[model samples]
Structure formats: C-alpha cells, structure tokens
Target chain A: MSTTLTPKSSPIDSPDLRAWKSASGGGDTSQPPGLLSGAFLQETLAMTRRLFIQLQRRPSTLVAGVIQPLIWLFLFGALFQNVPQGLFGESSNYGQFLAAGIIVFTAFGGALNAGLPVMFDREFGFLNRFLVAPLASRYSIVVASAIFIAALSIVQTAAVITLSAFLGAGWPDPLGLALVVLILLTLVLGVTALSLGLTFALPGHIELIAVIFVTNLPLLFASTALVPLDFMPGWLQVVASLNPLTYAIEPIRYLYLHPDWSLGSVVLQSPWGSISLGVCLAVLIGFCAIALLAIQPLLRRRIA
Target chain B: MPPAVLIEKLKKSYGSVEAVKDVSLTIQPGEIFGLLGPNGAGKTTTIRCLCTLASPDSGNIEINGTSVVDDPKVARQSLGYIAQEVALDPVLTGRELLQLQADIYHIPRKVSRDRIPQMIDLLELTDWADKKTGTYSGGLKKRLDLALGLLHQPEVLVLDEPTVGLDIETRSAVWQFLRQLKAAGTTVLITSHYLEEVDALADRVAIIDNGVVIAAGTPNELKDRIGGDRITLRIREFTPDDEARSAQEMLARLPFVQEVIINSAQGNSLNLVVEPQSDALLSVQQSLKEAGLSTFGISQSRPSLDDVYLAATGRTLMDAELAAVGTRNLKKERKEAMKGT
Candidate 1:
C-alpha cells in the first residue's frame, strides 16, 4: 500500500539536506572505522563539554571543594597553634606547617571524588549513550572526568593557598608556587584515574561510594598531611612513607619552609631513608603512571 | 546495497539466563521493520546486540552489510539508535544535546549547522529546543531524542520502543514523522510491545517470544495466515457465566466457528473466531436467537495482530505480557544491558 508523497515534505528536496545525505553514504565494510580519523577528538571534546556543562549548571561541587579545605586549614591550624615552634620542625608556625597538608589533601579529595559523577552516569543509564555511539575510545569518558576534576582541583588549591597566607603562612616563591601546582596536578591525575577505575570495577555506585568512604580519610591521616613523620611511631612512619600522598605532601611542605628550594632539596625523612626533592617528584610521576596503567585493563574490559 | 539490517542466529546470555536464545530477521532498506514482543521476550536484548552495545555470545549482526560484531564502528556509523529510555543530559539544552550527538557521530560542522535546525523544524521543536532537557515534558524529551538519532542521517535508524510512554497526540506525531522518514528513503527499525504501534507503523514485523522469533512476516500476511474473522458478542454488560457458556456453545456449533473464548475481564464478552464470510455475524445472531439469547451488541472485523500471536503461541499478547511481568528480572536486565560483554 503506497501513499502519495508530497514534494514539500521530503527532506531530500532541500539542497543542504541532499548534501548531508551524500556526505553520509550508505555503507558496508569488513571492519569498523575508528582511529585513523578525527572522530576521536570530536567525541572526546563532546564528552568533556558535557561534564563541564554539568559543573556549570550545578556549581556545588566546585564550591564545596573549595570551602571544605578552608575549614580544614583554619580549624586544624588553630588546633595545633599552641604546639612548640620546633615541634613540627623547619616550619616557623602551625599555619605554615598545615598549609602544605591542606593543599595536597584538598586536591586529593577533589580528584578522589571524580568517579562519583561517572558512577551516577552509569547508574542513570547515561553512559549507555556513549557506549552505543561509535566512539573512537571509551576511555574518553574517563579522560573527560580527569580533565574536569583537574580544573576543579586547581581552583580549590588556589583557595586554600590564599587562606593559608592570610593565616600567617607565607607564600612560596614563584618557582615554589609553580612546583606546588605541578605536585597538585600530578596527585589529582593519579587519584582521579584510580577513582574512575573503581567506578568501572565496582558493581554500582553504592559500592564505589563505600570504597571511597573507606579510602578517603584513612589515607589522609596515614599520610604526612596532618602530622610530621617525626611525631609518629616507627611503624606509622613506614606507613606514612609508603602513602602516595606523603610523597606529594612533603615536597610542598618543603617548598613552604624554604623558598630557595631546588630539585635536590631534601623533602622527607622516611624510616628507610631520606627522600630528596628529585626523588619525591619521581615518585609522584611514577604513581600517576602506575595508577593510569593499572586502570587500562579495567577500561578495556568494559568499554573496548 | 545489502539489507539495511540482518541478524543470523543471534544468541546472548547473562550467566544462567538466555536473554536472547536465538533471533534473526532481515530488514530491507527504506521500510519500518518492527520487533514486537512482551517485556521479557528479549526485544531490547536483540536491539542491544544490533546496536553494538551488547555482544551476542554467538551469532552475527550486520547493519547495511557491516558486521556489528567484527566491525562495530562501521555498523555504528550506519545506525542511529534511540534507546527505549530517552537518556538525555538533563543539564544540556535540547540543541546542545543534539550538538553533542552530532560530535559523537562526527557529523561535520557545516552539515550539523543546517541539519540541526532542519530537524528542529521538522520535529516542531523550535520553541523548546533551547530549554534544558530537564525542563522538557516526556514528549519533548522523546522528540529531542529522535532529533539526536536523526542528526547524522544514518542509513538505518534504530529505535527501541519509540512510544512506550507517550501521550496519544505525540504518539501519532511520531507515527507521522516515521512515515515521512520512510518516504524520504530512510530505513527504520523499531521494537514495541504495543501491538497497535507495530500494526499501525511497521511495514514488516517479527514477533519474538521468550527470546526466539515465533512469527515473522508482514502484518497483513500474518493476520491472513490465521484465516478468520473476529466476532465479539455481548448478551449483556457483564453477562452471567451460564449465559456466556451457552453463547460459547451455540457459537461453537456453527460450521464456520474456529474458537470461542469468554473474556470475563472485558465485561464477560464472547470473543469468537470464524471463517471469513459475509453472513458470519447474521448466522451467529440467528443461532443465539434460536437459543433464546438476546444480543446486546455484536461486531465482526478482520483478525488483528494479537489474534495472529495467539494462533502461533496459544496465548494473546496481553496474557503473555501479564505472565512476563511475574518473571522479568528488571534489575538483572539493566545490569546486563550496561555490561558490554
């Protein structure tokens, strides 16, 4: 049963529509087309734009990310204000000592929660939209979260650094400040990758949240974020030495104490040995590399 | 060109559940091919396999001659999928969502520039296109989803339950839009448990039951195969059981009567299937009168798609749908859909 067609209703009659029709040719092929074209960049940018749009519409994440750290910087700095000046060592005051901890932990916290949005996407069936499309790489989903979280962490670090200065913690030199930013970036990248990996590996958001809840504050206290390794027992020092955050924290703390810092400046005194600035940077870089590498198999298993 | 879509012995299982035991259908280009099934009959599973969202344990799925399993990117490029649920980003406006879809499909900037507006106009979405999807009504969200799926102008547009939850007006609008698409030479694949939706729209249909295709043919061909006319008779509104039984007995004695069932749920109406005859209704009424029965109402019509389903499966689509509701593990299905493998 054929119905009469109206010329005005047919899209093919439009010149631009006809051009689009020819541009997307009818097809059949042995293999799918993915990499050798610009579809990868196009899809990645779209995914990233979606995340940023979400952030813009609901700015609470960034707002809370910035404010939560200020609470820690102010309250914790005051709690230890009565401590002897030399008790924490190198730093002249409690605010100065707490500045480095707050910066690293704030950045870490922001990055660590990066997986929540992706988890929500999975739970809400939104990720299926990406999965069904011909994406060049599914890791674009993960990378988009990393990019958004990195931008957010930078903002939080700026807030914490500004507050710390007002609390009498002197500013690092320009070079030192740049290093601090670099360290925060490194930490955020690694943690965000790990968190996103958990998003895929865990069964659901509830489980991912459970994993995050368990991993968050313990890692913070176990590291050099709140207290110096010198104040901890021998066993605790070893634990702090092994925590990735400690490696991130010690360098920033060193920069705060000594503005004349160099790549060779000593950053941490672990139970095993003293760690220098160059080694701390190497460890942070290595941590980021390993975290990324470890999640590759998980991402491939799900999205490939 | 090859058929717009083809599946050969497609089978997929989630652990112990065979979500798609076996399914295969060929959809010719420029026609609306429908997959009609109940909730747990594996319609979505089949669509998932074809869309490259879920890989079949064993079988082949092709879109426009491209094997979805072996060459998914090519298959994906050829198919624009609108999922059963409109999975739009709530924060993104309708236009932005379409743009994102355009980018994902790698539609060129120039094409999308003109094409997006064309789609908005065609779907009559101009006024609401700038609003965030969160603010859109269900119908508006569905329209935007349709636009997103059509943005790249894929050769085959696959929609899972295009109007499962829609107002009557919007549903008709969608039906009209689909007809226009076919007129414009675009092949469409849609799955629906709504019998009328498939019957009214599909050029051809495959009725899947319990993960296997029970029947496949044009709607008219399937109905004709049943070889009967349906007659509904009501002695009274909510007729008494004894009267319904007597009516069933009288109708069964007719030489042309094939089957008669008392539908208590529908005011105890008597549903009869009989060989097509011009005097079928008159003969039934005469027999009822001879049995001292007074007909409150009587209507005869050609067999519907549901009758064809009953002939093949020994149960109406509504019965199967009700039965399926008891057994469908929706949580598991959602998880299985989300899992790529």
Candidate 2:
C-alpha cells in the first residue's frame, strides 16, 4: 500500500484524487490483515453506533420493552393474586414468583427482535453496502446487533426487577443481582444468536416474524416462568425441565427468595433430579455456546 | 498501467435465471465507462459481481491488477459502489451516514474530517446533511448517495443506474459531477439504460443485451460502426398501420435510404436508416408531400447509441425495455435484490 501511495504524489496522477490522496493521509487502503486490528474495531463500533442512534431517535421498542414486563407483573399478577400462598413453593405472593418469569421472558422477547433491523437492512439493500465495503470482518454486523440487543435486554430486565421489588419480590444481594445480570446476559446471548441466525437463514422479514410468533408464546407457557415445575403434570414437568428458560428463571427466582444462596444451592428440582445454581448457569452457558456455533454456517453463507 | 477496472468472462445466475453472462470490460483511469442496456440486460448483475456484492459463478474481476475474488478487501478499498436503490438509514442524518461510510472504508479520521464536509459541499448536501435521510426528496437522496460513494475518494467509482428515477435537474447535476471526477482522474463505471445518459457521459460503452455484450466502444465509435444516419418520420402523432407501411415503402425506395422500419409501438412511426451525408431527409419530406401526406414530425441526424443497439439486437432499446417488463418477475427480482444480486 505504501508502495502504491507514491503514485498519488506524482505529477501525472489521475485527477480529482487530491482529496482522496490526502484524506487517506496515513491510514492507507490496506488493512492490518488481523481480525482485531484497528480497522476491525473501528468498523464494528461504527456499525454499533448506527444501531444506537436508531434506538435513541425512535425509542418505541425500548419504551414497549419496559412497559410489556411491567404489565405482566402488575396486570397478570392481579389476575392471579388470589392463588393460595405457599402453594407455589414458599413465595408469599404470585407477584414474587412471576417477577423472575417476567424478567426472563422480557429478555427473551427482546433478544428475538435482534434480527428485525438486520432483516430490514437486508431487504432495503442497506446490508449490501456493508457487504461491499472493505470491512475488517463481517462478524461486526452480528456483534453490533448482539451488543444493541444485550443493552436493551438489560434495561428491560432492570424495569422488571425494580417493579418486582416494590411488590415485595425481595431484592437479591449485591452478588445475587450480579448473578441475575450474568444469567440474563447468557440467555440474551443465546437467544440473540438464534434470532440473528434466523434473519440470515430465512428469506425475508415476514418469514422471520412467523417463526418468532410460533415460538414466542408456546415457549413462555411451557417454561417454569409462571408456575413451579412441580405444579405441572408428569409430561409437562419433563417439558419445562427441558426448556432453557426454566434454567434461567429458577436460578434468578431462587436468588430473590434465598439471598444467601451459593453455587451449590438447589435452584431447580426437575422431574429427574435436583439441579444446583452452578449447573443452571452451566446449562445457560452451554445453550449460548451451541447457538453461537449453530449460526456459523448461516453467517458464512449470508455475510461472509 | 493496469486497467482501473477489469472483468473477464464474468457470469452469475440466480437459481435458474442467468443475471450476467459473458461480460468483459476494461476501464482505464480518468475515463467514464458506461454499461448501457435495458432493465434486465445484466447491467446491475455485472456491477454487483464487480462490486463484490454478488459472487460470480465463473470469471475473473480485478481492480488495479488485484483479483477481486481472491483479495476482495483490497479490491473493495479501490472501488466505491453506488447501488441503483439509495438505501439509507432513515433515522441517521446524512452526515451520520457519511461518517459510517467513511469508517467502513477506514478513511483516516483526520482525513475524513477535512473530507466529509468537502464532499457535502461538493455535492450541495450541506443543508441536508444534518437532516434524516427519510425526509430527503428523491433528488436529495440521490445527491447524498453520490456524496456517500465519493466520500472515500476511491480509485474506481461504480454507479448502478445512477440517475434512474431522478428529476432531470438532479440528473444533470450528477452528470456534471461525474465529468469533474473524471477530469480529476477517478475511473468511473456507470450503468444506464437511458440513451442520452450514456451518450452524454460515457467515454466508452458496452451495450449489454440479455446477459451478453453485443457491442462496446466509444458511443460515437458504435454509432459510426452501424454506418448510417437515422431519420424518424411520423405522418401523424398516431399514424395508422397502412399509412406507416406506405411511408416505410416510399422511404425504402429512395436511392440513399438503406433500410426502413415501422415502429408500431410508437404509433407506427417510420424509422429510416439512410446513407451518411445524404440529402434523404429533404427528399423524404418532398416525397411525403408529393404523396399528399403532411409530415407531423421529421428529424434526421447521425445514428444514436439506440440505433447501434437496434442494429445489433434487431430491436430498439425502448422495445427491448417494454418486452423485458412482462417476462421479468418483479417479486422474484426484489427477493434477488435483497440477496444483493
């Protein structure tokens, strides 16, 4: 690149490149050829910044994200307020139990929408602009989206946590609150990867929305978010046990109820066996790993 | 010096439909090269392949001697592409979008700092730079699109149907900008279906038809190769078929007239291919009057790029464009467009 840069300075140079030759002053066209070069970081942050700007201007998604979970905690809690206390494993009220569910579900729903902007960009031909540019790595496209969704999921999780605290859904200790964020981030990462995978794998936004629709409600109901695992009959017990959301919600709910919890504390007693909080976090991590690994082929086909 | 942009036997297909086939062009530095064709004539496909938005089934595409397929990053750095559809983030102001463009191209901040505003001023987009792209008028969008493409000051600028839907005022503005870019030594590759667009801007052109290059040269070279002048004679604004046929026959019998065709789609206007430097225009006018038919409009001049297209394809560009409309599946094409093909 340095070798070629000399020509722009020569007398017989092409016209109009005066700005280009100088504007490119030192950062030449050739990149460092490493994945984490200055160029890679710059492009990723720029793309991420674009997403942030979008969220800042038209914040309907953020507003709705906060409101939806609040509605679940208040409205749905009132609907089930009369449930006998202690029928759901020592929680003084349904709101206490349902808080964990609302938080996890809200994060899950937000993660599911990670792909919509990208799909729209693809449909509108904006993604092609990225594809054609000398990007350090196309993975920045996915990472930018993951970062945006993760941030939004955290905000939504905060709202659910705060409102639940007012409803006597006991707040976790400092360590416990950190655990909740860790669990939520893991869950968001896994779900966001899958959503972005669907964005590239599916033909268009309509098909993607269809997949999200079919999976959204059924997963919520099947998970232990709204009810204890023991409340379900035999087959549903097994189904809820298999659900990833159950693993996330149980540990977080345990954090709220038992502030002195350790990694060895039992979080979920599935139909098969008792699972510790450490095991639950391990399962969420594993789920996230699988989701990330699963999307490689699709990402390669679409973006690379 | 290597050609500023080069392609050899490039071909790409979407499912079963071939978008580009056997297209090859070599553009030198500081010249404007046009890929002129109808809507589905493989112009955009070829550009897509060259720009690395779409991969080719088989062929070699290069920029400044670097193989695009092998080292696309370097090729991309050398080329800037303006797609037919100006896809901008509605929420981002024009300045924001330009900044993104600069970052993606990895332009130095110090350089882009001095440059982005320079480009905004050059493209007359400073007033609209702070506004969201969604509120921009069609012309404003196009100018911003041009500004985005030129921001990095790439060596080769590829514009796919640059002014397709612009008002004439903006179209001329873009044309004038391209000419200045060429004078400044940027290699420009533009694709257009408009006859005057290519004739007005291209230093050389490749006439693509149905995924193949049927003719290529400077516009005048192509026009001269077809070896005749064009004379359009409309007996009336909407002449009947019989009247057109009679006019065609009378024009064909003239000593200097080489060929005559009745353009039925254009109200049966008679198109004549006459010997160069001949007095056939006056004779045809005299004959029409002698035949007791008043000429509604009669014009004769050197063969246009469209005449070259006609001579090669046996159909005028307008006819080919109209024909391309029916067989083209719009939904399928839009889907392909999303794939950036």
Candidate 3:
C-alpha cells in the first residue's frame, strides 16, 4: 500500500507524540469482555455518571418524581377522608391504607418512565456514540439505566413514605419497612427491564410516551392501589386481584396491620386462593427474571 | 505488518437502494487515506461498515489485522471514529465529557489523569474545558470532539467530514492536527466531499460515485492520468447561450483542443481540455479572434480533483452535491433505520 512521494510533497512537520504514546493503552482483546468484568463496570459507571450530571443540571425529573405522587396522596386522601367506619376494615383512615399503595405505585411509575432518557439518546444520535464504542456488553447501557432509575425510585419512595406517615399513616416496624423496600426494589427492577426493552422495541420517544400514557393510569386504578378488591364489583375485583400491584400492595398492607408478620401468613385473599407473602415474593422474582431474559435477544440484536 | 485497514468487496443495501455496491480498500500503516465522494455516493455507508455501525451484506473489514465482522470488539479497540455531527451531551462540561469518553474506552485512571490534560492542550481547549458544552461554539464543540476521538490513541482514526462546516482557522487547525496524527504513526482515514480537502491531505484517495469507486489514486496521479491541461475561457462575461455554443464549436475545431464544455452555471464559461505543455491557450485565443469573438477572460492550469471527478462521473461535484441536498435526509434516515440494530 506504500507509494513514493517526492520531496516537494513530503510530509509536514509535526508536534511531539510523547503525551499520546504515554497515555496509550489500546488493550485490544479478541474475546468479548465478561458481563461483570472490570471493563463493563467502568463503562457502566461512566454512563451512569453522565445521566446523573444531566439530572443535576436539570433536577425537574427527580423533583417531579417525588412531588407528583404526593399530590395524588393529598388529593385522593382528602376526597376519601369521609369513608364511613368499617369500610376499609383495617386502620381508621384512608391515608393509612393508601400509603402502601402509593409507595409501590410511585416506584412503578418512576421505573416505567426510565426509557425516556434512552429514547432521547437514540433520537439525538448520542446513543450511536456508545453503540460504536468497544463496550464489554451492551447490557452496560441497560444496567446504567437500571442504576439511575433505581436511585430515583429510592428517593421518590422515601418521599412518599415520609409524607404518608405525616398524613396520619403510622410507620411500619423496622423489619416491616425493610420488607417494603425489598418489594419496591423488586417491582422496580421488573418494570425497568420492560421499559428499557420498549426503548429498543419502539421507534422513538413519541411512541414510547404514548405507550406510557396508555399504561400509567390503568395499572394504578386496576390494582389495589386506590381501592381494595372487595370494594370493586365482581368483574373489577377479578382484574384487581390479578394485577401485580395488588400482590405488592396486599403484602405491605398486611405488614402494617399484622405486627408479627411471617412469610407463611396469608397476606392476600385473591380470587384464585389465599396468596401468602412468600408466594407474592416468588411471583415478583419470576416476573423480573422473565423480563430480564426476554430483553436479552432484543438488546443483543440492537447493540451487542 | 498487516495493512492498517482493509475493506474488500463490501456490499450493503437498504431495501432496493444499494448504498454500497462494491468497495475495496487497503490502507497501509502510518498513511492518510481519504474517501472522496459527493453526498449519497455511499461514502458514509462504507464508513459505517468499517466502524461497525452497520453490517454489510457481503464483505470483509479488518482493522489492524482484526476482522471487524467476526471480532468487532478488538477491531473497535483499534479504530476511533469521529462522526460528522457533534454528539456530546450538552449538560456535561467539556472536561467531564472527555472523562466520560476515557472511561468508556476503559482508559485506566492513572493514564487518563495525564491524558485528558494533554488532549485539552492539544486541541487548545484548556480555557473551555471546564465550561458546559451547551455554551460552546461550533468550532469549540468540534475541537472537543477531536480530542475525545484521539484520547485513546487507536491505531487508526477515521473522521467523517472532519471540517465540512468550519471557519477557515478551525479547518486549518483540524488539517494540522491530522498531519500531526500521521507523524505519530497513526493511520488516518477521512471521508469528505470537498475536493481540495482530499487533495490537500490524502496520501491516496478513492473517488466514489453512485456506490462504486470510479477512480482511485494520489491526487496528482489522478490529475496526470486524466492527461490534459484544463483551460476555462468565456466569450463574454455572462455569455448568451448562442455565443457560448458558437465559442464551444470554434474551440473544439482547434488542432490542440481535445474537448470543450459550456459551464452555464458559471456565467456560461467554456471549459476545455487541451494538449498538455502545448501552446493550446494562445492558439485558441487566435482562433477566437479570427471568429470575431470577444474574450472576456481565459486561464489554464493542471486538472484539479474536481476536473477528475467531472471526467469520471460526467458531472461536477457541486452539481452532484446540490442534487443530493434536494433529496434531503429523509432517504438518509430511511437508510439509517435499515441499519436496524
């Protein structure tokens, strides 16, 4: 490939290369890096830092994530403040029952919207920057999103819990609170996986937003978040019982009412049968596994 | 020892549109290779395949002897791609963005601690390094992008239109930086539609038209191979259609004149190919005087890369570029979607 050049067309004079050569690693490897390799963690942390920097510059997403559910808590709590005695069949006020529902739904809502940043990255050509890099795994992209969304969910969950506690909804014991956090995290993981999947499945942000809008409200109303299954008619009761949020909500509500809660204790009387706390945990884990597995082929096809 | 970059018989299509019909290139180490083509001539598609942004229907691409198709991770480690449009996250400061790039490339913290400063100084971005990229000017953004591309010091650096829309100073800075890269033993590949850009920097170039290479050689070799000294003469400034046609006929009849084309886009000036090192210009002027034609102006020089393009494709690069602009990026978007990650 070499061609001779006359002196008149000789190469130009240049600066020294010590700096560039000094910093050069260029660690070229034939094998793809493993999922949890140091390279993977490095890239994932870098990406997560970028997202956080953006959030720091523009704190509206985090602010809204914390505040939007509080608005729901206040508005709905006051609207249902007049529910007669024995209607809920639990603690005194609607706020007490609503707190668990709000915490779970808050985490779920935030997780569902995790794909927007990725979708924006796609449309704006920023994602192509990562796509062309020598990433260990494209799942680093998914994992980064998971980390950012998970952090936001924690902040939002804490906000909801604190606000609900102040609104006459008593706090669960330390163990009960830990269980509540575990449930919310599991639910967040499954929903976030689905959201990232949709980031690749759909064409652009507009369509993803449409799907989010179509999804956000119906899930909340269908689950036991706003009302118990028995409060609904027969058909609505069936839909509410089948909802995943119902599984999450009933377990947390049981923790609040039963001081000595156990995994074997029946937390929910679903239309199917008596669902124990352990069974609910198993279902959430299964959902999360299926979601993570289902998006693998899609992510591989998209970026791997 | 192997070629720095190799692409053989690459073919890719988007549905019925064949973006790359067949392209083969072998770039030696420590040389600057330029891919010159008008927009939509498959320059970017060929680049996309090389950079692992898109898979070709059939081809082989190797970077520093690693097959990009079979083992892209290693190939990616050896290739650095600087895209045409700046893709920085505006919210992040330039230093932060550079740091992010280094991390993603897995540059160790100890090296990057010094590496990032060297890059900032190289691009003369030290003052602007700590400012948010959203506040950067177009030239600053492009400079930062160049720094990011060079941070890891890949074996080959590929830039897609490194300076299509830049001020003269920035363009010169970029050209100088590329020269410095070559001096440091890095193979450089740039895709550009600018004739002078290719001529000025490329050690060798492939001129593509409509998804295939029509000509490939050193710029001087291509001009010499076409075998003519070009002359541009106008019968009159803003010559009328009839006058330009008559002048073209008169010039073509000359013993030294090989070809003549009326350039209506340039005030109907007549472009001519004449015998090299001959008194073709003087003879043509004498003939025009006998024909009672007024010579507005006339000049002669060695054929430029644009002339080479005109000879190969039967159209000027500007004309092809203008036509491409009319089609808009709608088709480009469709092609990008067909890449189908």
**Local accuracy of candidate 3 as per-residue lDDT tens digits, A39-80:** 899999999999899999999988888898899888989899
lDDT of 2 by residue, A102-196 (tens): 99998899888888889999888898888888888776777778788878888888888889889888788999989999998899888988998
- lDDT scores for all predictions? 0.83, 0.85, 0.84
What's the candidate order when arranged by decreasing DockQ? 3, 1, 2
What TM-score, over all chains together, does every model reach? 0.92, 0.90, 0.93
Ranked by lDDT, the better of candidates 1 and 2 is 2
Per-residue alpha-carbon lDDT of candidate 1 for residues B1-341, written as tens digits (9 for 90 to 100): 79999999999887678989989999999999999988889888888888877778998888877788877777777888898888778899988988888888777777778778877876667788888989888888888888888877888999999998887767877887787777678899999999999999999999999899999999999998878899999999789998899789878988999999999998889999889989999999999889899999999988998888888889989999888885878887666555555
Error of 2 at B212 (Å): 1.5
Where does candidate 2 chain B have its weakest 10-residue lDDT segment?
B332-341
Distance from true location, Cα of A139 in model 3, Å: 1.6
Provide fnat values for all models in the order shown: 0.36, 0.43, 0.45
Error of 3 at B141 (Å): 0.4
**In CAPRI terms, where does candidate 3 land?**
acceptable
Question: What are the C-alpha RMSDs, in order, of all predicted structures?
Answer: 3.8, 5.3, 4.4
All candidates' chain B TM-scores are 0.97, 0.93, 0.94
lDDT of 3 by residue, B11-101 (tens): 9876667889989999999999999999889988888888887788898999888899888788878888898888889999989988988
**Residue B187 error for model 3, in Å?**
1.6
Q: Which stretches of candidate 1 lie over 4 Å from their true place?
A: A1-38, A302-304, B335-340
